[model samples]
Target: MAPNRGRPKNLYQFHYGCQLFPTETRTQKQLRLALQARTQAETGPTLRRNLNRSNRSVKAAEEPTPSHPQTGTEQHDVLGFNEGPSLWEDTEEILNEEDEVSRARLRSLHQEMIEQQRHRNWKDVMACLFPAYLHFKKLTSNWTVPNPFLNLSSEVCACPVEAYKERDVDLIDLMVAAIDVYQSLKSKERKLTQEVTSTDQQDVLAQQSCPACFGVSIPNNDSTEPASEPADNHQVFICLDGNFQHRHHERASKNYIGIENQTLFVPSQDIESSNSEIREAELAKRVTKKAKDRCAEQHKAADDRRNASTWKGCDDTGLFGCCCRHDSVIAFCNIHKTGEGRGLPMSIIKRLLNSINPNVQVGVLYDIGCTLGKFFKARGLLTNHLLRLKFATAVFHSYVHDWPCQLQFNPRYNNGWGLTDGEGLERLWSYLLPLVSPLRYATRNHRISAINHRSLFHNTLGIENIVLTLKRKFIHALKTKKESEGIVHQFLQDQNPHERGQKYTVEFFRAQWQKQRKFEIEISQTNREKKAEQAQFYKRGEALKSLVETLMDSLAASPQSDPAQSLSLIQQMQELQKLQDEEAAKLGSLFVVEPGAERD
Candidate 1:
């Protein structure tokens, strides 16, 4: 290309100098500058002028600047390429405008990214909902109405969407299908009801019962009287307890027709100024007395309530009724906290008792047997059925009670309970908690609905009955004479057995029980002796005081009393005083107190 005439002359001149004396070749620019200055000082005006010219030339070659023909402002360019304009030469207004545009572009891009991410999240949610709905549909397919989805909109079928987009008809159909399925599988009479009503409906004809379902073949309640058995055989044993569910956030109570009916009173937060001094004093006295009385009553009730137990940290009470006979939950209620004792569980127990035959002995087992026992005994409601009623404590809970209580109420002593204890209720709660935990935060109605459905499903589904049926079949198969003979032959085929048969008879258990009773008796005697020893000290002190009083009375009557009698009285008094001093010293040392302070 031809050299441009408009280009700066210094640009070509600087290039020529760079070719001659390369700027980077010099180790130190400062050294070069110093040498030029020294030569300038030694030489004449011509040499000084040349050195000054060279110094300017070298600096220009090291960091050369190019400028536009129109604007004289120095500029930096990439190689020989010319950009439109430099910020150094541009006006401040133009620079500010560019910066503002850049920020706006950045913000727009950021918003677009966020929108894309949100759309992706919505799609994922819809995908999950579709599979869940399909699962529900599959579960209810057997009982669902014909062509439940026939009336669906094309848009609904086109893609997975949010629940709100579905037509009301579809939602209603889904709900109806769910209800139908539940009803089909559920027992005709809810939990133990058929048996309860069998007595009243004796006129009804006997019908074949389905083996796969939880049903009874008997129709007449007249035969409801349990077959005569040993006193140790019980028709049923039920365990009861309460479970409390916690809330993440507290909400104000909603008006409902359920059990929680007590009106709660909250103290006023706002305080008002009082004018009368005498009135305030009297009011304060009354308040203090009322508070003290309330505290005393609460403490007494707390001590009494140990006979029954409630779930820890749970304010809401679940009065569970578990049948130890069947190892299943028979009935449960979400009970309101009525009073100190387990009023709800007790009521439920009575209801359960009424459902069964009056002649059938029923044993009740619970965590708090002591409290329930006292309540049941004192209520007079069960006085007529007292002979049929037996109460015992759960094995796991017996250890927490006093030794006397353990001996009386422990399941080990209750032969009627047999092998299975009352812990069936505890196991039921464990299975139920995980299923209901997620629904807890929902409305109370929703939470209760879910729990009721699960409980009912477990009861009517025949899971236990199916297992029982299989067990009976297996036993029948094994009971055949051929099978029994074959098994016996197989067993005898072996020359020797690795393990021997172990058997424990009633006599063995009876002997063990006798030994246990004797030990318990010895323990009681020891306890009584220890208590008597404590009482003896107090009794001696009291006797000495009485003697001293009598002696003084005699001395008053006869001023010249006998010295020996007087001395004896003094010695007794001294002994009593010494005993009191020793007791006080022991008490002071055992308990925390201020240093040097007398216990009395």
Candidate 2:
């Protein structure tokens, strides 16, 4: 297949300047990769610097002293994988000199391959989309029409289709590509016409918000309304989370850069800036050798303690996402080296807020929202928009936080939250879970595009059935409200005696919640629930000790020495020890236990 000259008449005729992937032969990919490898080898030492390895090699080369014997630099982990230089910090730059060199080389090679002056034959056109496949409507070719389907569509299901389609491994990818291209083209056309699409990049809600939430929110009185509340916007719940499972390996693509930028993702440059800004600020003053939120440092995601070493083979270790209460896909980005960190979420949140009206009240629900809220305030992030935002933990994960944290951040305990669970992203992750393993080996462009495309599909389906969603929510809420009210009324009518002979009313609980919130505010981030627990621990321990001592004295006085008596005493002692242990745990839970702390 000889390549034709002059861009091969961009058959799709995209006047909006939208370019599709060209067809290409295996020769092109092979040649391009070969040249890239040759360039890297030519500039290898300087471009691919290995400071740690070089230092080890140099030390081994030198004469060894009796006190310090020479050691092999080559080491393997328990898994028998070599422990090479992995990106230690989340903020490490991915595009090094070698990366840039390879990227530039590929770009130049593509131009040369497409317009190879002499040839104008079928063989040279091997890379273009095969089947000369065109979206019936858009006429975009899958390949320029020579290129071995380099980008494989991610399998949402692991079931093999080789038996059905024969040996063209990327057949599924080819078929999916046409549909994806059509959808993208369709969306672009809609955007141009100013038609509302279910899948919007910025997630700008052109239509009305969820009916139950802010649609009919009552307007506060003039005096009580926030100064920034221009027209009494109802509260918006935005959930942010990170999924470490959605990662792609560095070896997946060879010096290839994805040309089609995915708008669903936060821009990489913005990611870098957020990371740099946060680092600079922390370095100057707020740097904590000992992080205030140890759980945050230990496990970035909620309860999932997958650390840096977990993704030794991957470049993108995870993803950070932001979404509305309806579980619609909003802005998200591939988290560089870290699991769940401050940079990506903050960047996404700030961008979403900036894109829309400042008057829109946003409540951000994260697994560790209470901790993040404090961090944001301390770092002076979102300072201007702080008034419009409320931070809260998702309902399911709220139990992980102490009572004080629950009072402040748990949606269930808070007023105006209604029935928002804040676990929307968790459900969203399940939808994308199928893309995890397959995408780990796919190209960077393929990974991002696949996620964005799938997310778009999710939103489209969600929008189409939004009315059904509202009806179900309304019915569920009504049932829950009735059942809860019945229980409350039953308790109110009960003759059960009160603790202090005082009546408990709804007003009493409301005032109590306000008082609890005030106390939480007065205390620092670490101090919440710990002081109360500590006091309780000492008081309980003293009482238990006194009781044990009194029982032991009584036994001694009787001088009882029977087998049955000894067994009874042993049982009683065991119960006391268990009680003491539990009381001690209350205090222990407040502090962050470092690795190997138990052994120490």
Candidate 3:
């Protein structure tokens, strides 16, 4: 083809200016030349602006809008492109079309994505695809943030979602971790707040003290003082009304007058108009004194009744029937039935009773371990007024033995007196001996010896039995005076000191003497049995010795009686027998030895 028509002046001018004075750096220019040569080689040849009218219109449509002539230089610079005006404009149009397509595609992708990337203009497009997208975003925006209690770390989030999804543990696990931290912080806050509130309330409650009786002083606004005091005796001062005060005074005045008085001693004016308050005060003092005396009498009567009512009982059927009294009445009452095993101290009993009821009469004494019937019999006799009217009627109850077999024999008693035999005698001595002696004596030397002696005496006599006897004798004395229908003094007068009389009559002594006699007879019988056993053992020993002697005599009288020959034969036999005995002894010793001993 003849040289194609040269490009139009505008197109040629554009290409010539780009090639002659390229806008790109040297490296860029070289790259562009290489790209241009590659494109030209692929296409074979090309001419500038070779287009039909339809092509021209489409190309023009692809171009970007021209910058406005009135636009400022800064606006023009911001709009600058590396390519010429037409190419730059075309690229801008393509970019604008691509953005529009992306925005349109996002609307159909997901409403959530559209909202997340809200900067793009997708509202119109999204409304077409999803009508409720905007509303959903608005409603859920506030709740979008995850709970802080949940452990929503990336690793946790990426775990096997299916495993936890059906179980609901994922959310619970998240909440649990989050809540632990939250509660720790919240608990500290709550504790601090409670402390502050409690302190405030305590301060308020501490301010007021009792206004009456002065028994309790109200706390000052800022002072720390206890609410009550024992010594305070101040009377309460109430602000009484005039009418109340008048009534009080009238009552006081009436109380002061004698019951026989029919009329006022003074004129009505003097009696009614005179300040009644002064006379009322005097009347009050007399009434208070009378009331105090009545109260004292009531207290004294109560104490007397208590003394008469307190008593215990025991039986004296055993060999050892010596009367013993416990020091503590209350302890006796508490552990009274404890017969041979553990005996309560009379002193401890007394203290405990006094502690429980201070009005208890300590002088009204009774041994805790006594037979039931004897105690009642004593009570019946001692109740008479003619026999030692000042002393209160007292009874005794017996102690029980510790061992079940002993307790079975003495069923009425419990296990408080002393142990049967001497198994736990040492323990009992350690526990009780100190209590019996004076504190000073106990603190001094020989404490252990004193305790052992007490235990031995107690064990031998059966402490419960002894305590019962003394209680019985006292009761008997009272009974004799009652039955004789005479005062205790009169009964004593009847018995002459010259007649070798007992201080107290012994109505129950026969039973005690009989028991003692039986005890002696039993002891003698036991000794006889022991002697018989010893004789039998001696007889057995003599029989064994005689049998051994008979065996030796038989051996000595054997056959072969030639003096030298028999002696030699006997010597040989003796040697043979000695050897056999030695082997047998060794075997017997070894067989008899115990396995344990062998190991040792």
TM-score of each: 0.41, 0.57, 0.13
The clash numbers for all candidates, in the given order, read: 3, 37, 55
Model 1 RMSD, rounded to 1 decimal: 28.2
1 or 3, greater by lDDT: 1
How well is each residue in 160-191 modelled by candidate 1, as lDDT tens digits? 45633634466764574364244323323232
Q: Show where candidate 1 strays beyond 4 Å.
A: 1-141, 144-234, 246-320, 337-340, 461-512, 518-600
Residue 241 displacement (Å), model 1: 1.3
Residue-level lDDT of model 2, residues 286-380, one tens digit each, is 66635666435434463334576777778888888877888887778887666666787789887877765556788888888888878777767
What are the Cα lDDT values of the candidates?
0.50, 0.67, 0.32
Tell me which of candidates 1 and 3 scores higher on TM-score. 1
- Name the candidate that leads on TM-score: 2
What RMSD does each model have against the real structure? 28.2, 22.0, 41.4
- After superposition, the stretches of candidate 3 with alpha carbons farther than 4 Å from their true spots are 1-423, 428-534, 537-600
Q: Native-vs-model 1 lDDT?
A: 0.50
Q: Where is model 2 more than 4 Å wrong at Cα? A: 1-187, 193-204, 207-232, 283-291, 294-298, 302-306, 495-504, 512-600
Residue 255, candidate 2: alpha-carbon lDDT: 33
